[model samples]
Target: MDENRKIIQVLIAICSLFFIIVGYLTYIQLFRSRDFMANTYNRRQYKIEENTSRGNIYDRNGVLLAYSKLEGEEQERIYPYGALYSQVIGYSSKVYGKSQIEAAYNNELLGIDDLSQVFGMVSGSNYPTRKGNNLYLTIDHKLQALGGELLNGRKGAVVAMDPKTGEILALVSSPNFDPGAKKLEENWQSMVESEDAPFLCRAAQGLYAPGSTFKILITAAAIENGMENEVFEDNGSIIIDEREIRNSESKAYGKIDLKKALALSSNVVYAHLGTELGMGSFMDITNRTGFEKEIPFDIPMSKSRFPYESMDKTDLAEAAIGQGKVLVTPLHMAMITSGVANGGIMMEPVLVKSIAHAEGKSNKELKADKLGRIMESDVAEKIRVMMQEVVASGTGHNAAIKGISVAGKTGTAENELSVKKKAKEHSWFVGFAPAEDPKIAVAVIVEYGGSGSEAAVPIAKRIMSQYLSQ
Candidate 1:
């Protein structure tokens, strides 16, 4: 009887263990399968690639940017424009895996439907004729080429977008690498180790002090706080916490209103205004404007930085003048500029305009995503007028185009590497063209580039001119 009872207990334990294993397997197949398939380190993607003919990537004008071709039983992914679209299209390699749009839409590119993925995995079926879907981007090839040309050899970025539709027109980051190079495998190690960091997408990922380009947001904050008409004294410099804040070249502008202050890019005036608005007001504006938050983008983006909690008045003063702890991406700056251009409504940027199957059937058509109003339309208008003054008669004079009304702000951000080592300031220009009804907004930054007016403004002007003329 004791032996029979022991045997029954062992049988019950075995049945329970079997049921538990079956349940766990079912959960993994239903819930965790996609995660497993999407893992870069997973060997299943390579298996899928074996049977799938990867799709091509095209610009808004149908200009071929990237495609795959079979050569002697081996498939080679080719980028026609080479390094020009490197950081944007990114690279898809069996060895190094994928990145950017290539990684973001890998499943679509491989034409792996849910059912097909499961079927292939379960049955080990061979599908040699499977073709991936093509991606149509919002990028304009001409604008992208022009931006690349302007930023070539520089360590910076340029981001241009349509204000109304949130469509990215051109995104350029310099110090790029050719992903389709013949010796890519051999050069990959050195490229990764290089100080230039050619793989880093400065437009979306690089963070830098926005300089006076940030003054646009500060100006909007002032208007929202009912301080738009307030006058302030600017005698080149002001003392806060025993530290003196000086204007560019320590030039004084005497007593000035917000408009003149912004037009002149007066650090002293803005610093004073920053103190007057207080930390609560400052934080409120930054929060509403997408600072210190994830900006929804097709590709990966670094969140623009702003202090989450109130610090010392000195820190606040420095931040108000676009210095100290504040940092931003070129893409975010462009989006902010677009918000001002789009009547205060910040639009979420779109990259992939559409996706089409191998049969040329449209799979999806993307639409504009509104992030809601960052400020009142009237407040944006007030800031727009100030920006116009900036381009017309102020530091951004070089950005003005003949027969076109341009509104812009110039920023020369201090780039100090340490307490002793000081690098040249980063040059920045953010603005929109035909001010009254803006078609395009742009942000340009030049690393170690001196004077936003001298280094960044002209690049922005040319981009706006080219896009508007189209």
Candidate 2:
């Protein structure tokens, strides 16, 4: 009787274990498998069709920038001015997938958990989908158009911002790719696999040494730290460790005033100033100016990081001239100038202004948020005066616009390491107008342009003049 009882107990235990395993397997196959399958398929088909109508993007003036239209039961996304806004409004596709603005606002535009209702004509009746809202951006269509025209086949980017609101008015990336062209099956593969990688948005992703334009930040740091003396000097080239450093063109402006050094973009003075300030001060300033941070905007933004690790005297000197370990995106440079123009306040840079459903109901409104105060108003004032002098009699004189207080700095960076043929240089300009109570701040970059004055400054002048007129 005892052996029989043991056998019965063993059978019951085996049955219980088998039932438990079966139940768990059922859960895994039914629930977990579906999620995994969805995730796997999302890259190819799920991102657009399932969640939401990819949001319609609009300019500040309510001009349609990007939108999706249904034709013959197929919804197609389109860009009216394809290449002009490619980087800012990244292309959405199955192969290239989504990037930049498309990925940034994918949730809102595709109506994933969106609270607003989207009404659509379905089967001779109106159907409401909680997703599918339109995104209104701060970009001005006319300004963006003009910026592209101004680029004129140059390999570079243009960024314009409202100093007060941190609203980007124009964001143009050159060598633009047409989203419409990619719509064709034959052209898609060629465009994506091309050598240029027109798919890569240069405005936010490309980083380069900013050259003399970096003097703006260095000068601001010097003035803020109370080291703004015309008599300050170092060995003309400070060899902190074992590296030999020399000023640009290997020329020095001996015993010049702080303002004069800024105008000439004297490498010697700024390098010495950077050494005095050290990495701690440099990091602090960049952090405050939003350089060492990510922009919290509706569109995707590349984080701006300044590498300070392994800093020797040589690297620091190079970094002082916006070279060496230091690299910045054009967007980052624009934010720095925007901070200076906004009276030391760093406003969160944004591309999209607001979002709404097809029924015209407001969904998500993009309000400009204050990031932080980077510098004191008084310090900004002093730098403003210096920058004004930069345009009046400095390297940036070419960027001078008539009847406007145009304060700007020019930069010419050598690109010996660039993969492009010719090993061309980079030109950079960052400035704001009406130096007093400024409204617009701009940053322009021309790749392999030879000189900042020769190639980059005129574009800035044209944009600033247009903004001032408006």
Candidate 3:
């Protein structure tokens, strides 16, 4: 009996072990198979991938930005523009992981992700993987260079895009690094530790409090909700649930219309508007205007966030003027301005214009897509007039250009942490030129760089003039 019992126990243990093995394999197949297939560290496949060359990358004007070449039977990635377009045309090293455009467009550059196009091969059968498709970006190299120059030496970012078509004209971030440098591997740790964060793509990834730049959205929201012709008395600041929301300079404009209030950037008036709209109505406009939505672009970007937890009247008041947990990327803010400039129709921002394949299957041009409207056409016109007034005779006076009707809003965002320490404010500006034609929309942010008119508007002016001149 004892011998029989021992044999039965051994058989049971073996069955249990077999089930465990099956379960482990199932888990890997269900959850981790795709990652394993795309792992770049597979040394055995490196030689095979080397033979399949990565494609070249170019700007809108057909200038080569990145390309790959053969080096001792190994594929070598090359970036010709150096640090000027570093953040946009990122490095793809076998040793170091990819970031920015390199990683974002990696599949297209490798040609591995083009499975549907596989049947277009010479024999209608994809035997061996072909070279990756070349990419033509929407970036205008000249504008990118000017943007880099304007933001140089300062910790900030600049983004310029076509308001109507959603094509990104120029995107730049200060304190850039050369992707071709051999020392990136050695200095990677220090680079990450640096105060300026040279490796970070500030234009798309860096988040900041928008300040009165948000007033544009607030004013648009007010108009959309039957408050366009509303009047508010501004005494510099207003109180909500005992919390005071004050203007930038703390000066009062006794009685004002929405346009004058926007021109003066009265926080009190905007805060009152927010409360009048209330949290539900305010959040509705926020969602409608592309907040908390995925920004469809060639390169991945951080989305602008509006926290909706623990709602109250004070929170609404603070958020109305772009304070109290409000954060946005420069790219996101540029799109917001673009929406207003393009007559309330927001377009999906595009960077990659086309993909070129040697298989005679050149990809189609990127079509402009609507990302939902932010306001009525008439409302956009009213806001445009107000923004024009801002540049004409208000806080954005310095933004005005000769023979050009510039529509813009200036913002001075106070740092939350530094409010107690009385630190410098971040300067901000969102503008579009030739107000009637509206060619380009720009967003500029200067870190701890005084007021928007002095620091940020000049940068926007130069960028707008450069594009409009062209």
Q: List, in order, the clash count of every candidate structure.
A: 0, 2, 0
The TM-score of candidate 3 is 0.86
**Candidate number of the best lDDT:** 1
lDDT of 1 at 230: 85
The candidates, ranked best first by lDDT, are 1, 3, 2
For model 2, residues 97-122, the per-residue Cα lDDT tens digits are 66677776665666544122222212
lDDT of 3 by residue, 1-470 (tens): 99999999999999999999999988866786445435667442344355466778888998889987766645667887788777888877767867777777666676654242334233332223458788888999989989888887798999999999999999899888878636567778788899878988899988899999999988888887888887889888787888987876689998898889999888889889888888887687789887787787777788889978666888888888888888999998999899989999999988898888856366867767999898889989989999999999999999988999999999988885458766678999999989998999999999888788879999999999888888
lDDT of 1: 0.89
Assess each prediction's global lDDT (C-alpha) against the native. 0.89, 0.76, 0.83
Top candidate on TM-score is 1
Error of 1 at 245 (Å): 0.7
Regions of model 2 farther than 4 Å from truth: 1-55, 94-96, 112-131, 181-184, 232-252, 417-422
Ten contiguous residues with the weakest lDDT in model 3 = 119-128
Give the poorly placed runs of model 1, Cα more than 4 Å off: 1-32, 120-128, 417-423
Q: What is the TM-score ranking, best to worst?
A: 1, 3, 2
